[model samples]
Every structure is written in structure tokens, then in C-alpha cells.
Target chain A: MEFTTSQVIEILGTIAFAISGSFSAIQRRLDPFGVLIIAFVTSIGGGTVRDLLLGDTPVKWMRDVNYCLLILVTSLLTIVLKRHRKRFTVTLFLFDSMGLGLFTILGIQKGIAFGLSPGICIALGTITGCFGGVIRDTLLNTIPLIFKKEIYATACILGGILYFTLLFFNLKADVAKVLVIGFIFALRVVVVRYKLSLPRFGY
Target chain B: MEFTTSQVIEILGTIAFAISGSFSAIQRRLDPFGVLIIAFVTSIGGGTVRDLLLGDTPVKWMRDVNYCLLILVTSLLTIVLKRHRKRFTVTLFLFDSMGLGLFTILGIQKGIAFGLSPGICIALGTITGCFGGVIRDTLLNTIPLIFKKEIYATACILGGILYFTLLFFNLKADVAKVLVIGFIFALRVVVVRYKLSLPRFGY
Candidate 1:
């Protein structure tokens, strides 16, 4: 089957998320099976959630064997390169950010296709972008980064808004998609580099 | 809208799970919003997952305002009864078991309706019965009880198998449902009372 550019980006995002999850599992000293499970959940959890909520099931991963193979291969690679854990930490951050940006746009596009309103679409986009990490953190017994002041979901929301705005003005679909993904990726990079965060509750 | 006995049982299960979630939130010293979120998630999380996996869109809760109202009232009641926490702990356990049994059967029934095989239906039943508490525990920053030595998911699986077995013998649907639910509820009660648990891996 011929793959589109969007499909290629989605595959890259899945690999990135899978690597991040594997790293978390290794750091937590989980067993091999645990590591694989974490990797699979982290890579596809968000998309699975979005599909399910949209009433699209058997889920995308179950429908496509390629996703499973990707996650499995990524997990194996991470496990094999455990000796270079320090080097991979940097890779993890980059992959995670890229995955977040790509998944957010994919989710927004899906919601729009489903004829949902802008606000709900934005919410779906945020959930799609950030929920994998949320599940990863939760399984590792930590507060989810998105629930903290990370500005993670914030970036997805902003990107989703930009997506709708561009479409409203009749921008080319490809241009809008690229710009939204770029915006989200850049925002995440800048926020982490500057150590910026939203204000937390005082009490 | 005439409601069937099965529907009533499902609503009761929802209320029970909501109360359990509210209790967990209050114990963890979560804010009011956190408490409400936990309650809502615990009450509907499993069924939402099942529906999503079944391609049943807008989710049952979105389609039914009564589920929301039920969870809201249950949360409020849990908060009001917080002063009687000691007494309510017992109530929480009872409700939790009841919810497990009802939800398990309901999930199995839905899977059968979808024409899935028995094994897949059993797995779906276990997920539907247990995932709410799993979500609640994860959000509260704890390992899920079902993943541990707890006989929770085991009970659901056993009950699901029994449900199919009864149907295979040409038993009535209502009778099968009731017997399966009773078996699960009883198993839970006995296991907890006897402090029984499955063996864990030494590694």
C-alpha cells in the first residue's frame, strides 16, 4: 500500500513514543514483559483512546500489524542499547516532543472529520497528544506531567486552534498541517529549554 | 423509557463504583474537582472503554444524562458522609464487589451481542469490570490492585466463563446473568474474607 506523508509522520511519532515508554520502563527496573507492555501502551495509548471515543474500534493498532511490529522493534532496540542509557535520554526528549506534535494534529483532523465543534476537537487533540505520556507516568506511579505545569497539553490546544484558524481562512490543507505541527513542536522545545511552566495551585 | 432489570443493575453498579472512587479521592486529599473527576471516571471509565472498543460512539454516558446525574449525586453523598469514614469503608468494599459483578456480566453480554468469541468476550468482561478501579488507582498514584495478587480480575474471568457455560447448557439469559453475578460477588467476598491471593513471581 502507498503511504502518505501524514502516515509516515504518524509512524515516526509511534516509534518515538514507544522509545520513551521503553526508557521509562528500564529506568523503573521493570521486567522484560513489563517493559514491552509499557512501550506498547505509551506508543499507542493516546490514539487508541481517540479512536475509541470516536467509536472507531478494534483500534488502529489492532487493525494494522505494522504498529505492533514498530513498537516491538523499538522496544527491542531500546533494550539492546541499555548500556547507552544516558545518550538515549536526549533522544527520548526529542522523540516525545515530535510525537506530541504529530499526534495532536492527527487527533484534531480526525475530530474535524467527525464533524465535532472546535472546542471539542481541541480537547480531543490535547488528549491524543498527551495521554500516552500520562498513561506512562501513571503506570510508573508518578503524577502525570500533563497534570503538572508542563505546558504540554497547552501547546496541543494552541496548535489545534491554529489548525482551525488556518482552515477557516482557506489555507491549503498541507500548509495548515505543517504549520500546526511546527508550532506545537517549537512551543514544546522552547518551553523545556527555558524551564517554563504554568502557575500551580497555591495550596 | 421503560428500563429493564439489567439496566437497573447497571445503574446500581455505576453508583457503587462512583462512591468507591469518591472515597479514594477523599482519602488521598484531592481537591473537590479531583474528587469529582475520579468519581466520574470510576463510574463510567470501564463501560466507556468497552463502548469505544466496540465502535459504540459518543459513549453511553454522553448519550445518557442520567449516568452523569447518578455519579454527581453519589459523589455528593460520599462527600457528605466523609465524617463517617470508618463506617463507610465497609460500605465501600461491598459496593465495589457488587459493581465488579454487575459490570463484568454487562460487559460479557455486550461482547456476546457484538458476536465476539467467548475468550475475547471474557477478556472484555474483565476489562469492563476492572478498568475503572485501575484508572482510579493510577490517577491516585498507586499500582492497580488488579495487576497485583488481588483476585479481582480472576473473579470476573471466572464469572464470565460461567456465564457462557450456562448459556451453552441452554439456560435462560436472566438466569445465567444472575448466577454469574452471584458467583463473582461470592468469590470476592470469600477471597477478601480469607485474605487469599494468587501467587506472585519471585523475580
Candidate 2:
């Protein structure tokens, strides 16, 4: 089957998410199967939730074997790089941030395609972006990153808003997708680099 | 508004499911918020998932605040009954099992109303019966019961199929619902009491 450019980007986003999940599992000293399970759920759980919500038939994963392959390669890499845990951490975080940005845009676009309101679309995008990480943390018995990381979900919400704003001004779809992705990626990187965060409730 | 007898039965099912979730949360030693979250998810998650899949407008909780209140009271009772945990556990489980039976029937009825085929209806019903616990477990940071519990999902599947069979036999909707619920409840109880289980793989 012929693939669209957007589909190609989505596959990349999923792979990035899978790698992030793999690293999370590795950090917790999970065995390979546990690691694989975490990675698979992290990569697909959000999309599955979204599809089920949208009443989309045959969730995206079931429709395509490539997604399975993407996670497979992602898990294998983490297994091979297990010994270089420290060095892998930085790269994995970058990939995860990238995945978060891309996935959020994909989710918003897809929600809009199904004729959802902008509010709902952005909410869905936030879920799409951060839910995988949330599942990953839950599986590892930890508080989810969205709760702790502060900017994680916030970035998706911002990017999703930006995505439609650009579209409203009559920008092309590809341009809007790219702008939203870049905006989220930059915000996440800056927040991490400067140790910026939303204030905690007690604070 | 005139409440149907079936609506009354559904409220009972909801209460039963909520209490079951609360007891499980206590068993897992969750905090107050945790207990509330568990009870709410357990009681409504299955049906919510079913409605979303059917593309129904306005999810169930949005329609009625009573369901949310039911879960809250159930959680409170769970806390007060802490000293009688075992007895309450039994109560919760019995009701929880009953909730699944009723929910499976509910899902099949909705699917049939939507004009879906028997296979889809049965599949939808199984999803409705079992997935709430899956969501509850995922939230509570455990492997889902569906993966570990013997015959949990299979019972739902069998019961859903039987529901359609009764339909084919020209049974009235109400009669078919009761019969299927009985079948599921009996099968589930027998399996749990007798420790009967399906093989882990290749059913």
C-alpha cells in the first residue's frame, strides 16, 4: 500500500515513542518482556484510546503491521544499548520529546478530520501526546510524567492550539503540522534545559 | 421521567460495580482520591467505552450525575467497612460479577440497536463487560485482570454469543437479557469457585 507523507511521519513518531518507553522500562530494571510490554503499550495505548473514543474501526495498530515492526526495532535497540544506559538516556529523552510533539499534532489533525471541535481536538492531542508516557509510568508503578514533568502535557495543548490557529489563517496542512511539531519540540527542549516547570499545587 | 424496571436494575449494577471497585482499591491500599477514582472507573468505564465505540452522543456520566454519586457513596462505604473487609469483599465481588453479566447484555442490546452483526455485537459486549477492570488496573499500576484471571473474558464472550442465540430463538429482549445475564453470572461464579480456567494460549 502506498503511504502518505503524514503516515511516514507518524511511523517515525511511534518509533520515537517506543524508544522512550523502552528507556523507561530499562531505568526500572524490568526484564525484556516487561520492557517490551511497556514499550508496546506506551507506543500504542494512547492511539488505541483515541481510536476507541472516535469509534474508528480496527485501531491503527491492527490496521498496519509496520507499527508492530517499529516497536520491535525500538525495543531491540534498547536491549542492545542496555549497557550504555547513561549515554542512552539523553538521546531517549530527545526522541521522546520529538515523539510527543509529532504525536500531538497527528492527534489534533485526525480529530479534526473526524469533525470534532477545536477544543475537543486539542484535548485529544494532549491525550495522544502524553497518555503513552502515563501508561508507561503506571506499568512501572510510578507517578506519570504528565503530573510531574509539568510542561509535558502543556506543550501538547499549546501546540494543538497553534495547529488550528495556523489552519484558521489558511495555511497549508503540511505547514501547520510542521509548525505545531516544531513549536512543541522547542518548548519541551527549552523547559528541560532551563529546568522550567509549572508551579506545584503546594507551591 | 418514568424510570424503567431495567433502569432500576442498571442502577443496582452500577452500585455493585462501584462497591467492588472501592473494595479492590482498599485492598490495594489506595488513598481517598484513589478509591474514588477506582470506583468511578470500574462502575462506568465499561459502558463509557461501549458508548464511545458506538459513536453515541454525550457519554453516560454526562447524562446523569447519579452514577458519579453512586460511586462516591460506594467508596465511602468501603472505607467505613474496613474492619469487615472480607465480608465486604464478598459482597463487592458478587455484585461486580453481576455487573459484568448485566453490562454484557447492555452492550449487546446497544449493538443490536445500532444494527451491527452478531459477531460485532458479541465482541462489543465482551469489551463492555471486561474493559473497565482493564482500565482500572492500568490506572492502579497493575497488569489487568483480563490477562490474569481465568475465564473472565471468555465467559463474557460465551454469554454474548448466547444472547444472540436467544435472539435467534425469538426470545423477547427482556427475556434474552435475563437469560444471558444468568448464564454469564453462573459461568463466572463456577469458574472462580471451582478454580476452573481456560488455557493461557490459543483458546
Candidate 3:
């Protein structure tokens, strides 16, 4: 009945992603239903994809109504806090970074649990960390930030490698998880702060 | 083992979708790798999503290497036909319609297999028919055809309803499927020919 640390991270990440999605919808001046749909998809799209690829159906959100409620509540909060949008920008960045880090590790862990190859696990981790944004951006009719030059998926991949490396050396699972998450979080913060990005590929 | 009519339709649909994806990539002037990736994802993305939501894992393409080979071959064919591109527009439209029809029924059947509600089944069918194009258009940095005035998803939904209605009346499965697929295909052809489209929604 007790929520594990990992579970707590997942919940927090879902809320963060949902808020970001709602923020995007508001920015785009979408209708209320559109805003809610965007928030729901952004919050759960990546995990839903990972679960589907892993053949784990009925999906996580469907299994627990709490996650849906959490997303709904987070999205509603965005509407209330719209007037103080500038203040929420800092909160958005923090939550987004935390979501990216936690989701990356969670994805890698799920891949490992499924007994997938290391390469596939890393890919899965990256997909889990970034695909929701891709879906969100696609729906919003903008180029996905990650695909452009955000250094987002890169951090997830690096963290995934670090995670497996630590596990290879027989490090404790919790310690490895914390370190990997920290690495991804720090990497993203540093990248954004310095305006570092991958070089754009020209056609 | 001999392939059933449904299985054949599915294979043809995959090939058709792959060609459409490759065509989009080529038009966008993507590199060879990008073209291949687009083709592969477009061919398999929808079903992969449907499977994931249904909790069926290892995904269909991964379990069957033939699909990958099919996509690869289809993409290569596109490259060859590129020089004769003017002759291929009609071909593209036909293949695209066939893909839409096949994937719609396939998705609905999968949803039914998973014991989902009728409404969810129709939604699954529409997603299966339309999401690949969504992903392809997103990757190509264009608005998805379905989201525009195109009668894309609408046709799928209508066909799906017909499919279920026929089944509800205890129609033979193969007959119902063929009728549904034909309905979608014909609807698309008619809508495109008549330049009929849904009214655009403005914020």
C-alpha cells in the first residue's frame, strides 16, 4: 500500500508534463477540451508508448485512475495560475527537468525488467523521456524541440549509459537510480543555462 | 501456411503506408537514412501503438522480420520510381486509400480482441488508419492531412461503425471487413474527387 520512491517520481513527472502541456494549450489559445486532451497526452504519451512496446497493456494510467486525476488537477491548476505565468515559468523548468530525468531512469528500468538488450534499453529510455514532447509538439503543429537541438534525448541516453555502467559494476539499484537521475537533471540544467544544443542538420 | 484474406490485406496496407512515408521523406529531400526511418515508422507506427494500448507486446513488426524487409523493399522501390514521379501520384493515392482501409479494420479487430468497448474500438480503428500519416507529416514538418479539411479520419470512423453494425447483425466476418474497407476507400476517393472537406475551425 506504500508508494515507492520510484512511484512518487512517476507521479510528480506526470504532473509536471501535464502542466507543461496545459501551458502549451493556453499559449495556442486552444478550446478547453483541446487543452485537456493535450495535457493528458503529454503527461502519459511516453509511458503509454513504452508500455505498449513492452506488451504491457491496459496501460499504467488505465490501471490507476489516480494518474488521470493527477493530470486533470495539474492542468486545472495551470488555468488558475495563468495570471502569474511568469512565476510559473521557473516552476515549469524545474518540473520539466525532473520529469525528464525520472522518466528516463524509469524507462531504462522497465526495459531492463523486460530483459531487453542494452542498446534497445537505451533507446527505450530516450523514447520514454522525450516522445511525449514530440507528440505534444506534433499536435501543436510545431517542430519538436528535442528533434531540433534541445540536448534533451541526449541527456537521457547518457544517463541510461551511466545507469547500466553502474549496474555493471554491481552498484546498489537505488544508488544507481539516484545517480543516473541526478546526472540527467544536471546535464539538462547546464545545457539550457549555457544555451548548448546539437548542431542542426540542414537538408 | 496459407495467408488469410485479412492477413493479405494487412501486408498490402503496410507496404502501401511504407511507400507513402518514403514518398513524403523524398519530397522533403531527407537523406537516405531519414527516408528509411520514415518509411519504417509509418508502416509500423500505428499498429505498434494499437498493440501497446491493447497490452500486446514485442509488437507485430518485431515478431515478424518480414515487415521490416517489406518496408525496406518498398522504400527502395520509391527511390527507383522517383524519376517517374509524375506517373506515381495516382498510384500513391490508391495505395494510401488501401492502407487506410486495411489498417482501420485491423485496428478495430485488435481492439475487439482486447475486449474494449465498441466506441473505443472505432477510435482504435481511426487511430490505426490515421496516426501513421500524422507521424509522417509531423516528421516532415507539415500539418497532418487528417487534421486539415481532409475527410481522412472521418471515413475511417464511418467505416468502423459500419463494420461493427454488420457484425452486430451476425454478418460473416470476411464480408463485413471487405464491405467496411470498401466503404472507407470509396468515401476517400469521392471526397477527394469532389474537393469536399470539413469546415476549418478558427480560434
Candidate 4:
């Protein structure tokens, strides 16, 4: 019963998004069912979109009920832990960024498997990293952060480029994967920490 | 130079959604580029989602460049017709409802092709009918009308049920398809005209 590295990353990412979505839903004062639905969507949304684009049918979650159970449990735990609401924002951000990093790499790998071009793979990675949050925010009736803030997708794109570059330099696959994930997570944290944002056009 | 019934319905649905999307974007004060983008998503978003769920690779627009061109033309035409602003809302509703009916039948056909259960086919039909508008409204930062108002999806669902019933009664396939589409379009118009709405839970 050994889980491959990709499997591990996927599980971790799922949990991270589940936590992120649950916190956001609870913050919005959604009912428990609504919170759970948000958690479920945030956990599986990106991968589902990625699979759909690649024509991978039955979608991952539809075939694997375990992922659904995992989200249910994780969301319930997050709800039960709401007494520690002081750290809500930080917790949600951290988990979301972590999920973004992990899911981006997974999407890139899937694209590579499908023989998609490098640029398309990077686009897929960015989509996989950002779409879950986009769906979550959209369902919550807010402008998606991806459209409002550029750095979110930027980090994933940069991480994708770094992955390809590392592989070009003959870096071990596992090492490059870990490095790219850490790079994305750290980049997002630094950008937010420094209050960095792209200039917007006044419409 | 010959076209099948399905192809005609698909084209009509695409054009209808493109108009619906462009009008929505223009009303939201988006620029030309933004309007076109919204129109593209509204025209293809549901089919893309349905294909992904069914693992249909390359999706429709990706494989057929003609659809893209059609959407582009349709969107531009919609923008040009913008000066008829007084009738915008009514025009949008008419095209949207027509697209919903057309796309719903197409989706149900696809589901049957895949040998999916009737229930699942109906679900797919509803998704195909409604998701483009859902995506368009979400991108525009509005609560998707499907969630806020029940009749949107309800019309699709009822039409799906009607299609199966018609078939069960040995109605010709072509006749049933046309009837279902007209039924959905009329049902939605009547629902909105009468201001009928499902009661909401005050949670």
C-alpha cells in the first residue's frame, strides 16, 4: 500500500482546498450543507476541469468516492474547529496557496502525459491551480481573486516554467517536482506578504 | 451543403448563446474584447462542460474552427445591434431560452449515444442547457440566474422528462426532439411572464 508521490501531492492538495473552501463558506455564514458543498467543489474543481479538458471521462471524483468522503470529513473538521476563528484568514490563504502549488504540478504532469505542448501544459497548470478558487469565489458571489489579482496565476505559471527548466538541466524528477511546488507556495506567500499587486486599468 | 437536424440545432444554439452573452457583456459595460470573450464562453461553455464530463476530447470548438468563427460573427452582430437597447432584456431572454432548449436536446442525444441512463441523460441535458449562462453570469460577477431562480433549470429538466415520455409513447425521434425544444422555450417564457417562482428557504 505505497502511495506514489503524485498521489500524495493530490491528497494533500485536496485537503488544503477543502479546508480553504470550508473556511470561506463558514465566514460567509453559509449553512452547513452549503459549506460542505463549497468544500467539495473547491477540493475537486480544478482537477475535474483539467480532466474534462483532456477528455478523461468519468472525472476523477466520480470514479473515486474516497475523495468525496475525504472532503466531507475534512470540511466537517474545519467546521468543528471554527472556535479558532482568529486565524481564519491566514489558515485559508495558506491552505489555498499550498493547494495551488500541488495542483499545478499535477496538471502539468497530466498535460505532459497527454503530449500537449509545453505552453499548453503551463496553461493547464495555471488553470488547474486557479480554477477551484475561481469557482469557490464565484459561487460565494465575489469577483474571483484570479481576475482581481494577477499574482495568483503568475505564481503557477512561473512554477511551471521552472519545472520545465529544471528538467532541461537534468534535475531528478522528484527533486524538480518538490522544488517547483515549494517555489510556487513561497512565491505566493511572499507576494501577499509584501502587498504586491499588479496595476489595474480604471474602467 | 446539406445539414442534419442536430447540426442545425447546434448552430442555432451557438448563435443564440453568443447573442445572449454579448448583450450581457455590453450591458455590463465591458469593452469589445470583453464582450467577445463573454460571448465565446456563453456559446461553448455548456457543451465544453458536457464533453468533459463525457470525456469527449478536444471539445467541440477546439476541433471545429467553424464554431469559433460563427460565435465571433454572432457576437459582433449582437454588439452592432446594441443601439436597440430598449428591447435588450427581452431579446436576451428570447435567445437564451431558445438556446437552452436546443442545447438540452443535443446533450440528451449525446448522453444516449454514450449509453448513459435516462436520468443521467436528463441531468446532462440540464447541464448543457444552463451552464453557459451560468459561466457568463459568474464571470460578470453576478449570482448565476440558475441558482437564484429555479425556473431556468426546471424548464430544461421538464423538457428532458417530456422527451423521454414522448419516446416511450412511440413518437418519432425527430418530432419528439422538436416538441421538447419548443416545450422548454415556451415553459421558460411562461414562467417569467407569470412571475412564477419557487418559494425560497430563509436560512
Who wins the lDDT comparison? 4
Query: lDDT score, residue B168, model 2?
Result: 83
Which sequence of candidate numbers ranks them by TM-score, best first?
A: 1, 4, 3, 2
Candidate 2 C-alpha lDDT tens digits along B1-203: 88875786678778777877887788888889989889999989998877776667588888999888877887798678668656865765587789889888777777777777676677678778877777887777666666554567677878987877888889997888888888998998898888877432110
Best by DockQ: 3
lDDT of 4 at B54: 85
Model 2 misses residue A100 by how many Å? 0.8
Off by over 4 Å in 3: A1-40, A46-56, A61-134, A143-203, B30-34, B81-84, B87-90
The digit string of per-residue lDDT tens for model 2 on A13-118 reads 8988888888877776654555666788889878877887787855666446567778978888867756665566587678788889988987887898999999
**What's the DockQ of model 4?**
0.17
Cα shift from native, residue A60, model 2 (Å):
2.2
Q: By the lDDT metric, which is better: model 1 or model 2?
A: 1
Chain A only, candidate 2, TM-score: 0.92
True contacts kept of each: 0.33, 0.07, 0.35, 0.30
Q: State the DockQ of every prediction.
A: 0.18, 0.07, 0.19, 0.17
Off by over 4 Å in 2: A199-203, B1-203
DockQ of candidate 2? 0.07
Q: What total of clashing residue pairs does each candidate reach?
A: 0, 0, 3, 0
Instruction: In angstroms, give how far residue A98 of model 2 lies from its true place.
Output: 0.9
Docking class of 1: incorrect
Our model 3 lands, by Cα RMSD against the true structure, at 7.0
Candidate 1 versus the native: TM-score?
0.61
